[model samples]
Target: MDKQPLLRNLETNQPCQPLSPQLLSMAATAAYPGAPQAEELASAPPAHLFDNVTGYEGTTAGGEERFVPPPLSTAEGAGRHEPHPQGAWSIPSITEETAREAFIEYASSKCCYSAKPAKEMVFRDLKSCNTYRYRLESFTESRSTEWTSEPYKGQFVDSSAYGPAPLPWSIIVEIPQLFQDNIEKVPVPHTSSIKGCHSCMAMGRRACTNCTATGRVKCQFCNGRGYKFDDRCNRCHGIGLQCCIQCNGSGTIPCETCDQSGQLMIYIQLTVKWKNNVLESVADQQSGLSADLYEKMIGQNIFTDEQVRVSPIVTFPEIQINQASRKAIQEHQVQLTRTSLVIQQRQTIEFIPITQVYYEWKGKEYNYFVCGVDNKVHAPDYPAKCCCTILCAVPGDLPMASGGQTVPPANMLDKLAGYESIAADGEERYLPPPVYPAYNAEGGQPQSNQQWSIPSISEDTARQALIQYASEHVTYSSRPAEEMVFKELKPYNMYRYRLQSFTESRSPEWKSEPYVGQVIDSSGFGIPPPPWEVPVDIPKMFEKNKKKVQVPNTASVKGCHKCMAMGKIPCNDCLQTGRVKCRMCDGRGSMLGNDTRCNHCMGNGVESCRSCSGHGQQKCDVCQGRGQLYFYIQLTVKWENNKFEQVIEQQCEFPTQKLSKVTGKELFSDQQFQVYPILGFPDPRINQISQQGIQEHWTQFGKTSRIIQQRHTVEIIPVTEVQFQWKNKEHSYFVYGTENKVYAPEYPGKKCMIL
Candidate 1:
């Protein structure tokens, strides 16, 4: 019979491939750091060995059973109720003088208002209408299990070696105190088992995929052309191939699944999660005040109850409050009990008062509401009206005539002639309305019709603005902006279109290769679905995700191609000679001085090949020396959100890039699984771009990938370009977006280096 080839102990007869004593010691120590020595382990009793197992415990006296906590004792008088308060719950009303003062203060806050209406308007009546709010909290704890694994480092195995492993849920673990939100992970005792690594089949190494087991790979520097720009490539020295970096020219890598130890420790891990769930509701007062305003206010705590589970309040005067509590408790129990354990529940009731104030100005009537203990006001119509030109005037320093009455300057009186104001006697009065002229007060043609115009700032205000701006920017100098002549203020507005294409796509490719001990995934073994037909759940938009699955009916075994079924290949290093020319003597059989014998080769001129250890052949990496191959198809599912944005060109100096950092008022928004192009948008450019984007995405990605979802939106970004003059030079700044964010790129005072 032919001599059997060596497998695990290939280095036994070859000195060139001798195993290192230090390496073996380190590997053994790392595998079992606290394990007893081989002799001691062999002599130790079975019971002692089991006791030493990590995260393992002996079986309980009873069979597998879920552990349940003892029931909580019910508190006495848990459902008792208190009688509702008599009379309406309302705060004292404000006096007429106080209301008038509030209106005057509100008027003074505006830059353009004359404050005449506030000072003269008479109070008709004061109506007080008040509202109430309620809240509930539920705290819960939940438990779950999942399979987890780690490298087997001689850990105790309960299955097969010891006996059947303990059930996952039956494993005992310490439960944390309830009510507080927390999480804990515990490994189920006696559930761990040892399995041979499926990746490398206990060989501790795998063929390097990058080099295809040849110990060399194409040079990336020259794209494997051996030359770059008609010159010899320095990276690969014109050889076209370089030693594989991944395997360090060994053509093999340590198995990651087993951490190079060739075995895996598998166990079940239990996760205990604690959570606090809260629900709230409010009662409507029909006071015409916005319900949302009540959210910011705190109310009086009329009733309080704490128990394992509290009953809904039935004695409350408001039917809505009682019904809201009942609905909340029922909903929490139905939703949470399905997945988590309810630890404790607490509920409380609060009363927030809202009062609406009604007052009349001239002959017409208007009202303002005061809410909560802090007296927050919501007055959309405050009676006082003004023109946009007032934006340029200094706040709180309105132009005044004699007797404290606000009046326009003689120069502006002509401009205010066309506007009319209503007085307290229900008659028309001639009052100066704040006017923002296109030209300066000195009279000149407007700078740009495309630009928005605001009143020019006074020299003092300009100086203060420069000082504040310079303080914020470390590289700025305030001298230039402060010394320059104050000029005109111009504003510009721009719009942009943003299209987001969120797609979930699947691509299938035939992947046939030699198999080792990989577990066959037959989950997709039925009729394969078309790439586009595969149903996949949509994930969060704009998030990139990827997953792979084995294609159905595409797996098979075939003869190995690299070795031609021989399971071995001639060693490339020695070229099947089993020996290589001695490096010390250069294959001359003698060293320097002619007669000096080659000690390394003993004058033979050749040494055993280090790569194959003089065996003339190496195990085929393609089949892992198995002489067969496993062919299959792999499907890759990718979720990607492609965002395309285009800003319409503007006729102003505002930087388009600045709009990206700030959010604008969304003019139009649409989202769907697959969206149609937008139509009838106010801006024709927006409609055109929407159509172009949809078509381009379909043509580019739709052909190769399935489209999952798409969302597109248009926004009117408020861009106010303010142009001003300083020291006879013109400068501009931008006040953009609803937030009124300022962006001044070319401030007159910048680039000043501080020594």
Candidate 2:
């Protein structure tokens, strides 16, 4: 016997080594300050002394202008244009307090065009006379602004960052860690159900109409069947009677009530509906409508309070007539008539006066100006003027004149002496009415028939149709008659009469024989057999198989051997308890005296069941090991063309004092600003566009100045110094101080210098 060779395999495992301290420190240093440190000195070479190429000296060999430049920075050229001057004082950066004061001052200033109140004249047209009266009104002031100094009002505040100062660096660590631990696990949802069912036609056992829907029928042989019953008949054998031929089996005839169809005709109500309700108040407005009628039809009472008043201006009432009739006209009466009538009406229009007077609402002063009305007149006799004035016309006749000389009477011969008539033949004869010839009774002659001949049917078609028809109708007994007739009636060939046939008999020419087969084989030439075959049976085959499969056991997998090497066996952690705890009663012993579960197997008893984990089944930690956890996010977007529009109107209520209580100084400028009227530069365009200036008043303002000129100047401050001072200090400065320039003085080295 040969000695068996021994084989053994040994395996050793080791863990990865950590990096050295020096290399780790060097990597940490390189990553310090992130991208910012690299960017600052990015274009310069490393600062190590060995990398320097140039020698050190007090100055570069090429001097100041030739020195090389370092890389550009983000802040380099930002304020290149604004340079500080050598001696001027510089403004310090703004502080929050100073900004607040400036903003407060801005908020207190008033607009320049505020209006003031004043007393003004209004004219009214009365029944008999025109009246003029004065009333209070508002007008715009030349300089209406009011201003006060205060603190800043325009600044934005953020509320989210208002907490105590933070150690800004710590946010980088805490935010991500907090979010990662709190993530929620979401579950998967069930999907919609899908299923299908087969379709089939309806069928059932047929019912016998003779017995109606009831299965039993009367026995005809037994008649009323009080006692002695007859045996069921075999073709009525041994029975007294059989089923009637007319009624088909049972004794009763077809129902005379429903005819044969077994259906009845009767009237039935189809549908009913209620009418709409009418309130009593509404019915009162429409007097012809009755609320009681509506209540009866609608089955409910309606309550209403307000009476709606409808205007005749918008809706008119229907017209009424007393009577109407139509009749044949046998006679008529005619008459001529005349009448005189007069009508009068009053007309009014919006009236704007030629001269308008104005006064201050809280002051004694008043002012006046004019805007003329426009009018037109087509009749040359009436003069066109403003409608503000009244025009009265006097009714009087013109004086009848013994004013001019009279002429002589007319002589008839002078009017008619030269007139002559050209045609003396009784007046011109009228032309005869145009004649239209009558239609001829025969219309037109018929055309000759010699043009084209009609086609004739083939002899084969005629004979074939006759043969088919005779075959269908003739019985077997009639065949002999048909054969005799057909043989006698069949068409024959004709030949011209001649005596030469005797020579053919003596020496005959060759002749051909005809085909004898009754059936035709025309398939190759494409004419199909006259009667085609109908397909009868279609065959189908199917095979269905069902089977079960088995998997073979193979090699054993490697277990957690590291735990085994420590002198302690590897525990089955899947059981969730150490020592695989007794698998029955889940490690609890049997109650009373016996093991409630198998003693050798522990509480689980068996193994690997999906539930009970088979020693059987335990919780799977992988799905916690149950299954996978899914994540989902629900998004809701309310869309309208992806855009929404809203129209908003904002309103605010403010305190207002009565005009009567406001003082004159609050309404208009103080008397000190008032002055005597004076002439100012004239606006030629105003004069040119005026209607009166274009017509009668052109010479009053200017002659040669069609005044196409377009500008004018109105000085708010008068010639008096008191008025100028009262208006404002700025106004005073403009009128009294010497002129000064606002720009800075120039210097040699700098581009701009302010003084």
Top candidate, metric TM-score: 1
How do the residues 38-81 of candidate 2 rate in per-residue lDDT, one tens digit apiece? 22111211122111111112111111212111122222233322
In model 2, state the lDDT of residue 640: 11
Q: Which stretches of candidate 2 lie over 4 Å from their true place?
A: 1-584, 592-640, 648-755
Model 2 root mean square deviation, Cα atoms = 62.2
Write down the lDDT of every candidate, Cα atoms only. Answer: 0.60, 0.20
State the lDDT at 347 in candidate 2.
11
Ten contiguous residues minimizing lDDT sum, candidate 2: 324-333
How far out, in Å, is residue 341 in model 1?
77
